[model samples]
Every structure is written in structure tokens, then in C-alpha cells.
Target: MPKAVLALGANQGDPARQLALAGAAIAAHPDIEVLAESSVIVTPPWGKTDQAEFHNAALLIETGLSPLDLLDFCLATEAGIGRVRLEKWGPRVIDIDLIAYDRLEMESERLTLPHPYAHQRDFVLTPLREIAPDIADWLVNRIGTSSA
Candidate 1:
């Protein structure tokens, strides 16, 4: 099994409850095993800052699914949670991002391992640091320290 990191966030419609629902969905997946989860934290909106603050958390999991499959699962999970792609960086009901997949590094039309912007976002890094400090440290160091 390969370990992967995921970042979860919601800024609309009961943010905390939305995160809890996402956690449940992830745990319900037969091919995935939840390893650790970070405490949910409130973060000011990023990208498009006009929305409400977001509830954010991170998850560490061991899974039998391939990276692309995991990405698809995330997308499906978001849609299941009522996410609508109305705008880029727009407010969302739930957002699940596959931040990293083992030590793999690759980018295709649908997915990218070691999420290109994870290091630059504190909402992603802070919760990740709580459950997986080493991975968080590596991401920060790997990408020249984060200013967030």
C-alpha cells in the first residue's frame, strides 16, 4: 500500500460538518485506510478572498488505489458533497485535494503528485504538519520555505 496526503476544506454550508462528512466518505472507501487526521482549523480564504473563512484539515492514508484513481475518488467525493464548479477559486461547499502520493512525482492532465502549491498554502501545510510533520517539513524545505 502507498501512503498519501490529502487536504480538505469547506467555506460554505456548515464547514466543520462538511469536513466530517468528507472524513466519513474517505473512511468508507474499501481500498483506502485512514492513518491519521489533523484537527480541523479555520483559515482565511485563499485565492479568492472574498468568501467566508474555511475549515481545513489534512489526512494521511494508505491506499490500494493508483494516484489517478485516488484523484478521481476525490473529485467524486467532492461532487457527492455537493460541490459545483461555478468558478475557479470560488467559494466551495467542500474541496478535497490529493496533496501527495507516496514519493511519486508526476503530472498529467488530470493529476499531479506532491501537489504543486501545497507548500505555499498554510491552510494545507498547517494541518498537514499536525498529522505528518516530516512530510510537511520536506514540502516546505523542498520548495524553498513557505511565506504563509
Candidate 2:
């Protein structure tokens, strides 16, 4: 199995509860094992600043699923939790982001490894730094480089 980092956030319908349910759901997946999780933090809205603040955290997991499969898994988890893509960076019941996957790097229509914006978002990097500091380092080192 390969290790990956997932960032979680929620701004509506009891954000804290949403994160708890999401963590449990992810951990319950057959192809995934939750190795570690971070404490959630409150952050102001990012791209879309008109919404409420968000509760953010990250998780380290060991998974047998491939990158795209894992992405699909997260999306399904979000939908199961009543998430809707009403707006970009808008408020939601839950938001799950695959921050990194076993040092793999690639881009496709549906997903991107080492998420294209992970290097620049404090909300993403803060919790991610908690469970996997090395990944935080990789995100920072990629900054200002061609890949970023």
C-alpha cells in the first residue's frame, strides 16, 4: 500500500461534525487505512470570501487504491456526506482534497497529484504539515519551481 495525504474542510451544517463523520467514513473504506489525522483549525474563506469560515484538517492514510481511484473515493465520500458543488470554494457540508500520493506527480482532467494549489494554501498546508511534515517540505520546495 502507498501513503497519501488528504485535506478536509467544511463550513456548513456543523463543520466540526461534518469533519468527524468524514474522517470516520474515509477510515471505514475497504481500500484505505487511516494512519493519522490532524487537529482541525478554523480558516477564513479562500477564493470565495463571501461564505462562512471553514474547519480544516488533514489525514495520512495507507491505501491500496490507485491515484484516480482514491480521488473517486474521496468524491464519493463527499457526496455521501451531502456535499454539493454549488460554487467554487463555496461553503459546503464537506470538502475532501487529495493533497499528495506517494510522491507521484501527474495531471489529468479529473485530478492532479501533489494538488496544483497545495503549495500555496495555508489552510491545506497547515493541517498537512501536522500528519506529514515531509510532504509539507515537498510542497514548499516545489514553490517557485516550474512544477508549481
Candidate 3:
């Protein structure tokens, strides 16, 4: 099974509960194994900053699903949690980002491996560093230094 890293966040509704629901959904997936999860942290909004602070966390998983399949699963999970896409970087009930997939790197219409912005966001890096320091280091080395 390939190991992947996921970054999770939510600012609207019950942020903590939203994160917990996402974790539960991921754990329930037959094709995925939850290897590790980081403690949730409150973070100031990134990108569009006018929204409420977000609760962020990270997950390390071993999965049988391909990258695109995992991305699709994440999208489905967000929708299931009441995410509505109304604006770019808008507040949401849940946001599940496929931050990394093994060591694979690729860009498609639907997904990108080793997420394009993983190294730049503390909300993504801090929680990620807690659960998977090796991956966090790899991401910084591969990309650039993080502002965190």
C-alpha cells in the first residue's frame, strides 16, 4: 500500500466536529488505513483571510486507492460534510486536501501530487510535521522553505 498525507481544515459550522467526521469517514474506508493523525489546531485563514479561523489537522494513511481515486474520495467526503463551493478559499464545513501521495508527483485536471502549496502553509505543515516529520521534511526539501 502507498502511504499518503492529507491536510484537513474547516472554519464554518463546528470545525472540530467537522474534522472528526472526516477522520471517521477516512477510517471507515475499506481501501484505506489510518496510520496517524495529528492534533487539531486553530489557524488563521489562509488565501482569503476574511473568514473565521480554521481548525486544521493532518492524516497519514496507507491506501489501496490511486491518487485520483483518493482525491475523488476527499471531494466526496467534503460534500458529504456539507461543503458548498461558492467562492475561492471561502469558508466551508470541511476541506480535505490530498497533500501528498507516496513520493509520486503529477498534475492533472483533478489533482496534484505533493500538493502544490503544501510547503507554504503553516496550517498544512504544522499538523503534518506532528504526525509525519519525515514527510514534512521531504515536502520542504522538495518545495521551498515554509513560512511556518
Candidate 4:
């Protein structure tokens, strides 16, 4: 099983419900096995704080899927939950981001493995750090390891 980490967030609708549904959606995939899911962390906002508060959580997953497969899962989850990617960092109904993938490094026009901005954003790092401070610290220390 390839280890992976995902960040789950919601702000538009019932966040708790969205979070649960997102987890369920991920688990619905036969290849994705959830190891441990961190408790939801409610935060103010990131890029656009003017919108709404966000409920965030980190999910440790094990999957046989490739990086691109995981990215497609995330995008599909967002679309399934009615996410409109109109504005940059705007309000969202649901947002699922692949934070890490078994130390994999990938760069594509569609997505970047080990999310480019995972460290700087408190929304991503805080809940992540809570679930895994050591990994979070490493990501912070190794910011320049990738294109970030």
C-alpha cells in the first residue's frame, strides 16, 4: 500500500457534514484505505478570509493508486460535492487536496504532488501538524526541496 495524506476542507455548506461525506467518498474507493483521520480543525481562512470560516482535517491514507490517480480522486470529490472553482481562493463547498504521497515528487500542469503551498498555509499545516508535527516540520524545513 502506498502511503498518502490528504487535506479536507469545507466552508460553504454544513462543514461537519461535508467533512464526513468527503471521508466516506474517499473510503468508497476500493483501492483507498484510510489509516487514520485527524479530527477537524476549524480555522478562519487562508487566501480570502473575507469569505467564510473553514473546517479542516488531515487524513492518512494507504492506496495502490498513482499520484495522478489520487489527484483525479480529489478533483472528482470536489465536483461531486458541488465545488465551483471560479475564483482563486474563493469560497468553496468542498475542497480535497492531496498533501503528500509516499514521499513522491511530481509536477504537472494539472497538479503537484506534496502540495506546493502545504507548509506556509496555516489551514493546511496546522491540522496536519496536529496529526503529524514531525512530518509538518520536515515539510517546513524542506520547503525549497521542491518548486515551492
Write the residue-wise lDDT of candidate 1 on 42-138 in tens digits: 9899898898999999999999999999999999999999999999878999999999888787889988768888888999999999999999988
Worst 10 residues of 1 by lDDT: 139-148
Off by over 4 Å in 1: 145-148
lDDT of predicted model 3? 0.93
lDDT of 2 by residue, 49-92 (tens): 99899999999999999999999999999999999898788889
For model 2, the superposed segments whose C-alpha errors exceed 4 Å read none
* RMSD (CA, Å), each prediction: 2.1, 1.1, 2.2, 1.6
Better of 2 and 3 by lDDT: 3
Q: Of the candidates shown, which would achieve the greatest lDDT relative to the real structure?
A: 3
lDDT, candidate 1, at 136: 91
lDDT of 4: 0.85
**Cα lDDT, all candidates:** 0.91, 0.91, 0.93, 0.85
Estimate the TM-score of every prediction: 0.95, 0.96, 0.96, 0.92
Q: lDDT per residue, candidate 3, 17-135, as tens digits?
A: 99999999999999999999999999999999998999999999999999999999999999999999999988999999999999898888888777888888999999998999999
* TM-score winner, 1 or 4: 1
